[model samples]
Target: MPEATPPPAAGLPELPVTWRASRTRAVLLPVAVLLVAVFCVLARAMPHNWHTNDRVALVVTGLLFAAGLLMLARPRATAGSEGVTVVNFVRTRRLDWAEIVRVNLRQGDPWAVLDLADGTTLAVVGIQPAAGRTQAVAAARALRDLVDAHATARHRR
Candidate 1:
């Protein structure tokens, strides 16, 4: 039988901090703005026979695009000794290592759920498996390690 490699040690291992893709915002913003401007121009230049639905569609699409663009432009994640910070555009949540009960890298939206001592789950959004399998796993392991270290340190204190 061939020998198998040993698994890496547990707890938040040192990792090169990585910033998730903000490109979605970068591309969306300009397109949204341009779309809004174009719609406005079209509405003004067209004859009175223009359909109301056209105007409504333009406004709704523009609004949706603007919102998406704004979201992408902001910071997504920052990992440190204390914990990982995640920003979901509308709100921001910070999870300390001690507060996290388990680190799961499962199917669907790739996220880390922090099971706080209080029993609430804080979802960390930016760490998606769709980003890349290797990178996602590495990040998950580092986060799990962080939680382990925090728990150990607290018990020792």
Candidate 2:
């Protein structure tokens, strides 16, 4: 298994780092564009006798499908010195480094999951294996390091 590169000298990574599922975006974006094009072509090909509303509805349904695909590609995470922001499909949440107890990306898992101090696990879609296992492992390691660094600092105070 690939390991993440070591953290910086300060025992913490650089602030304001962002992670995204590049593969997901690469796949979904083009599909979305293609869907729109197909819808336009289909709309124009509809029979002249068909109701305008029916044609419009067909186009609208295609648009909605494209939108849904875009949403699936929307997951990302940004980590700063203060906290991390997680943006999933429909919800966004922020958490301090101390709030994360562990960062796990086990084999066969779809994405990284954060074991929180509150005993809940939060899925981090941004660091998914869909992007590549090496990338996912590196991200999970880096995040774990950040959480550890923060926890250590907090205990000293």
Candidate 3:
């Protein structure tokens, strides 16, 4: 069993709250740099008999790999007064407050999932446990509170 979260204060959270996976960026950024460095060194060290194309290929491959890693670090979510904008690895989606029915982050889940009124779930990678368990939970809770508060306000209007 779990305790209920209190309602957020009126006009709380101020709007445009943004969440990002800092840990993901921290780890991948250095790894990408290291990878590119290694590729450059390898390119320079290729056998004298090897063609220039081979060396170029190695460096190009490394750049592509680094780009992919950086993409994984690109997920973010921003909550504004009108809606939440979720940016995942390859796509971005915007959802109005009323369109979100629930926010869930169960144990073992990779990230927070927003259950939309349309019966679809959107994974919010910006609030992932891979960043930090406590941090992820807090972020998920805050987003949920924002959704709840907005819904309540809408109903009263």
Q: How many Å off is the CA of 20 in candidate 2?
A: 1.0
Tens-place lDDT per residue, model 2, 5-112, is 224546456877888998889999999989988997898899899888988888898899999999999999898867789999999999977688888899999999
TM-score of each: 0.60, 0.89, 0.89
**lDDT assessment of candidate 2:** 0.85
Candidate 1 residue-wise lDDT, 34-110, digit = tens = 87787677766777787988777767777776667667555356766556677765788776555678777776655
Scored against the true structure, residue 22 in model 1 reaches a CA lDDT of 39
Candidate 3 residue lDDT tens string, 26-50: 9999999899999989999988997
Residue pairs of candidate 2 with colliding backbone atoms: none
Q: Which portions of model 2 miss their true places by more than 4 Å?
A: 1-12
Candidate 1 regions with alpha-carbon error over 4 angstroms: 1-64, 72-75
For each candidate, the alpha-carbon lDDT, in order, equals 0.63, 0.85, 0.88
**Candidate 1 colliding pairs:** 11-145, 12-145, 12-146
Clashes per model (N, Cα, C within 3 A): 3, 0, 0
